[model samples]
Target: MPAARSGSTRSRPIRRWCRSISRTTRSSRIVSTRPARCARPRIPISTRSSPTTRAGGCSCARTPIIARAARPPAITAASAPRRTRTRRRRPRMADQNLIENDEPLLVAKSLSKSFGRINACRDVSFSLHPGEVLAIVGESGSGKSTLLQLLSGQLAPSAGHVSYRMRDGVARDLASLGEAERRFLFRTDWGFVHQDPAQGLRMAVSAGANVGERLMAVGWNHYGRIRDTASDWLTRVEIDTARIDDAPRTYSGGMRQRLQIARNLVTEPRLVFMDEPTGGLDVSVQARLLDLLRSLVAELNLAVVIVTHDLAVARLLSHRVMVMKGGRVIETGLTDQVLDDPREPYTQLLVSSILPP
Candidate 1:
């Protein structure tokens, strides 16, 4: 019985040792599987463990497997800040394009005008620079007036475009402008001086009232300030202040002309069309008025189109001149150059008329 008991004890120890060997073999196999299975597939799945990391068991290749470096706890809020930040930042970048600078002040391309059956103006092309006078000189019925009418938006063109671009980047088709828009944007920016200044003025109204009427037309109702503003321009044009409220009929022809000028000028128009601003006046008054006009135009930096049969008027008050005959411009050049050296016969004739005998 003692021998049998001793044999059982030895068998029990051997069985326990066998169980331990099996367990160790299984653990080594699990650890070795990562490199053999995972390494050769691509980037190796590693089995070298750290306190902060755990990896899936993968059999890759016969090499030492190293784990990816451990990271801190995931901060979910910080990870996605870029997506939220981009939404707020995008509009600031987009707003840079708004209120862009305007292209050009005025662009008239292949402009033409007709009166019933007559081709009054044909393919006339010119650009008016800011604060420059562009004198349009021609014989009677040569379409100077018609061109002005087309340019100033009083008459529609038979063909082509007259586009006025404002400083705010709004392009207005002068030919296509509605009545209210024209009155609001156009009439305020442009003024027309008739061949006879009387044609531009309301002779029945007082001198102050003549200018005050424009303020009224543009929705200004401050009568006290309007009258004072009218007086200021009348004084600028050298009209005596006492006659500010007097009827235009009471003033002499020269005073009436000066008052009419005040009527056109007080609005500070960007462009003014003068049919014959210096016409039908005595030399002394003409000289005075010319000086006044020159000074005002310079001070205000106004762009003007002065139409005159008198080439002298063209030379006296123009930077550039176009000599037109029979509804077509025969010659165009800088005022001094065109007048000194005429190219066409019609232009020569116009120039010849200006020389003293």
Candidate 2:
């Protein structure tokens, strides 16, 4: 009986232990199914993620949950607009001032330049309104280039004066502006595209730098913003953005010219001067460039003064045509009137010379 009692006592303790373990297992399963409460310190509701957390600790502490919530949304097309919209940035001056002021944007009065008894330009008078494109057409030595230089302040006119309307609705003579003001105007308000890209682009620098330099000159110091702006202009000129890091010297003739255009247009200049921009290019390249120029001019409402010997280019790009001969404007009128129905004999001969393609 004593042995049986001892065995029974031992069996009772084992059975008690087994019952306690079973109770613990069942309780744990119930607790898990009922959703374990978070043991982490309470944070702001905004910082909190979904309430569904694992047992023992909060996942927020292990992972950067707060940072993920605080992060900005991804940049999508709807959220971020294209850089081309930058053209509209000067609406206050371009739209309001242009409307309030009825005067022409640019005016030249009897502009003449003489180089040692040789007259380059004589009695050149014209006015350019906002968003107008004027084409100067003539043979090689028609003084178109000289006239352009005088209008752009690259040369001092021997006889006449050039006046430009400022954003403040005041007309000021080009000569009246100080050197610093002229430089600022050139950087901000004017763009010059040479026939030769080498004359316009810095051959040693990257294409992006060539474009960004103008922005820098105008106090753009943010590296990221400058890069984005340069990239946008390059794309507008149909240049592959992948080649932005390449130097201008590495680019082809057409690409160099396009890069030059992008460089000039990045600052969104009010006035652009082009000297045979499509000169010496392949026929296809010239056509493509002309189309691009036309679209950009129309889109930006830019005022352009372009010098070209190509009559086709003048017809395609200009609102007004100025015919030059012997350092004088032989004919001047609307592009269609001047080209389709020539009033001057010289212009008639010039038109007849172009065999239809």
Q: Against the true structure, what is each candidate's TM-score?
A: 0.68, 0.73
In terms of TM-score, the best-performing candidate is 2
lDDT of 1 by residue, 1-357 (tens): 011122221111121111111011222232111112122323322233222222231122112323221222233454545653444545352253232211345667777888778899988887776677989988889988888888888888888878886656577788677788887764477877775766778878788888898888888899799988988888888888898878988887788788877888777777788877778888788788788878888888777888887777677778999877777777888999998988888888777877683
- lDDT of each structure? 0.69, 0.82
Off by over 4 Å in 2: 1-101
Model 2's alpha-carbon lDDT is: 0.82
Q: Which sections of candidate 1 miss by over 4 Å?
A: 1-104, 355-357
lDDT of each residue in 1-357, candidate 2, tens digit only: 011132221111111111111011222231111122223323433223434322332333222334334434445566577675445455676577467436798999999999999999999899998889999999999899999899999999999899998878789999999999999988998999999999999999999999999999999999999999999999999999999999999999999999999988888898999999999999999999999999999888889999999999999999999999989999999999999999999999999999888
Candidate 1 local distance difference test against the native: 0.69
